[model samples]
Target chain A: MFQFKYPENFLRALGKPLVVFISRVGELSEFIARALYSCVTPPFYPRLLLKQIINIGFYSLPVVALTTLFAGMVIALQTHAGFSSYGAESAIATVVLISVTRELAPAFAGLMVAGRIGAAMAAEIGTMRVTEQIDALSTLSTDPYKYLVAPRLLAGVIVLPLLVVIGDIIGIFGGYLVAVYQLDFNPANYINATVNELQLIDITTGVIKAAVFGFVIALMGCYNGYKSKGGAQGVGEATTNAVVTSSILILILNYVITGLIFTE
Target chain B: MNQENNKIEVSELYKAFGRKRVLNGVNLSLKKGESLVVIGGSGTGKSVLIKCIQGLIEPDKGSIKIDGFETVGTPRKDCEKYYATMGMLFQGGALFDSLSVWENVAFGLIENQKMPKKQAKEKAIEVLRQVGLGADVADLSPSEISGGMQKRVGLARAIATKPEVIFFDEPTTGLDPIMADVINDLIISSVKKLGAAALTITHDMASARKIADKIAMLYQGKIIWQGTVEEMDKSDNPYVRQFISGSAKGPIKVEI
Candidate 1:
């Protein structure tokens, strides 16, 4: 199958760089999915890995929550100001919740968390790698994938859903605050409109998107770190790649997932 | 001129980075419980040779037989089992920053062997004590320790599994002479106590003399000379003599 695209001998002769790059991407995705699979299975490292999860996951609540809140408020004010000039100000609450719940919550939370934490994961693992601790781990008979890559991936999938839920709430509340207080919309009416308009699917879709984004963030981090070669320069390159790839992936995937979820 | 007995046997090994050969037809063997140091100028692939034996870097062609198990291109699964009986002290002490000292030492036992944490911790401390470190250092992060202390901790971690073979990559490069000797002494005693074969790579002749029963000199990707400590002094190889004497006025050209 591989030979159809390139000459068989030519591909085989390409060597470690070729294997490292292609397998790097595949192994990263597999590493993440494997972690998720392992998390759900037995012999769990709950206490140990959870401490890592809290580090990777819960500690970033302040940032995710804060960003969502302001984002929601800004979104509300913008939606209201534009509509009110057109004498359709009443559509503000509907627009705010739809945008916050369906669009902003998962996208913003995943991007924010990825920016803040993905670099740390890549740099931490990348440094371990460059310093040969990963080799040390192997010499000690520990699988670096099972121990290091698994924990990061598992936490990303598990924790981002919760973060997305929080982001959704904070984002809606931010929109509510702006709509009621700043936009001069009736508080009860705005609340009623938001409540009526938000279906179960809206929240579910956004949370699902957040989970995928979380997985991608972690995948990028681990891939960059795992594939990182050289010394300080390589580690720096990996850190940059982790953050940039996670951000770009979050945006691209958000559209793909949203289209699938929301299309009639 | 090996004495016909071999502990770590490497034959016809070859490795390359892109088109540049790092190890070219390298062949070496050391006897059981013997300390062999490979000395060479920087980037002469001294480290690469040790890595091949340790299975850190797979050789493109050759055989590395540790207790008769062929290591060249050994599958990663079998590689783990091969690694369980081996230890390494990375040039920079490579301790995991996220793990506390005790956890780092206990990493193998807990993760690979599935030993209980309590037993692993106890074993980790015991090994730490063997390296002249107190058990009190266990809870601290690796970052909290001084370079010498960190080196000791790395030594502790290396010997924790009581491995059958150990590789020390520039084991004393960054330490002061006194600390270097301290590490050298610890390496000797611990290897003796564990009855493990030890291979070290370094430019420090003092360290090599203190730790090695035999030494080899690698130059331009080949083993130019190897001998007992007594023979090392009388070695006719220009590279080995220049290396052991630390002479700048020799056939060696410094890359400056």
Candidate 2:
């Protein structure tokens, strides 16, 4: 009587990844829940919140402005090329404005901030975890979630929308420059077309997406960093994982939100 | 020290990380105003035991009671009372890099006790003075300080709150002999001044001998030997002898 050892091994192999994935999802959800809970609780640190806002918002302005400006300019040039073939060159301003406000600015700004702020949060918290500073905080009667994670999450939610709003303005300005001087479109016509086509719903959709993306970025960064172990290599891995996971989540959420908001 | 009133009581403690059991059935008790040092080689779970008491790492099974209040599995809000009564000096100082020395020392006071900043700073400075650090060093960041000074600052932070109990994790691990002695002296004086119960875990024989009123040796996830310093010197246990003598040839196998 032969036992089905091969089938048993196959089942075990197949179940391993499934088990790991389920557990990872469970842990991530728990982390996000705790972070959100801490945000509303007491023992709030205004100083830390202010510091993170400055770090994540004020310092990020230049980079966000540059990325969206270039993105807007490129979008105008490309739309001019594509639409000109269809004899729709006058649509360049409308396309650039809608794309910048409803898509490019928010998405680009989210990805950029994820790369910058997400990695920094991960590295800082991972170091704290490895060095036992996080534990030290607990032993000192301070909750690490209340002290560290809450501030970052709040700052991210508040500041990303502001950055995206600024990005939208700069991006539109960039498109204007390219449309007028480079493409030789009449300046007055371009401005009128942009203003006529822009809608409150378009700007609101981007702002809402930016807010969600910001929360995801900070959540991933803090979760990965807090759980990091094994010293320097662990911290490095957490930093990489923070940026990767946040960027992917931002893109995925952007599509999901867009579908919800714009679906006919 | 009155044995009837135990400051901390740990019983049947068990902790494991994925199949590697770090602590098994560890039982120890410290009386009020007593100093107990747990000595063991690296990888012996000394740090894990302290962390369990501090509620930093939850043990798989254990009962840790402080002043007769059970701490294991207590809600964080309820545990704050226990945390406020205890102080810990981490193995690597573990100072917040973002904060200055004074800010670090005053952290518990400012954050937990809700003390005003100016008063907290004055208390921090007073604690620094107790640790033989000057007022000038208070404003400097931890990274700017020497390792010895950092250790002293860590001690200052630990004692600044005037807690009833203190835990020192490798207080003199990374220091010169003189600096180690200085730390040992500071630890002794701070405990005496506060009349606090102290629990220190270290592999340094000299530090352990100097700081402990009672001594315990941990091996293979259990306390293999425990006695007073004088009793420790005269103990006939092979594990204790081999450990105290720093001999490689013994019942305790060197992993290498």
Give me candidate 2's interface root-mean-square deviation. Answer: 0.7
Cα lDDT tens digits, model 2, B139-232, are 9999999988988988999998899999999999989999999999999999999999999999899999999999999998998889999999
- Model 2 segments more than 4 A misplaced: A1-11, B1-4
TM-score of each: 0.90, 0.97
Task: Note the residue pairs that clash in candidate 2.
Answer: none
**Which candidate should be chosen as best, given TM-score against the real structure?**
2
For each candidate, give the TM-score of chain B. 0.95, 0.97
A111-225 in candidate 2: lDDT tens per residue?
A: 9999999999999999999999999898888999999999999999999999999999999999999999999989999999999999998799889999999999999899999
lDDT by residue (tens digit), candidate 1, A84-188: 779988787778778887889888888888888899889988988898888887777766776777777778888898888888899989998888787677889
TM-score quality measure for candidate 2 = 0.97
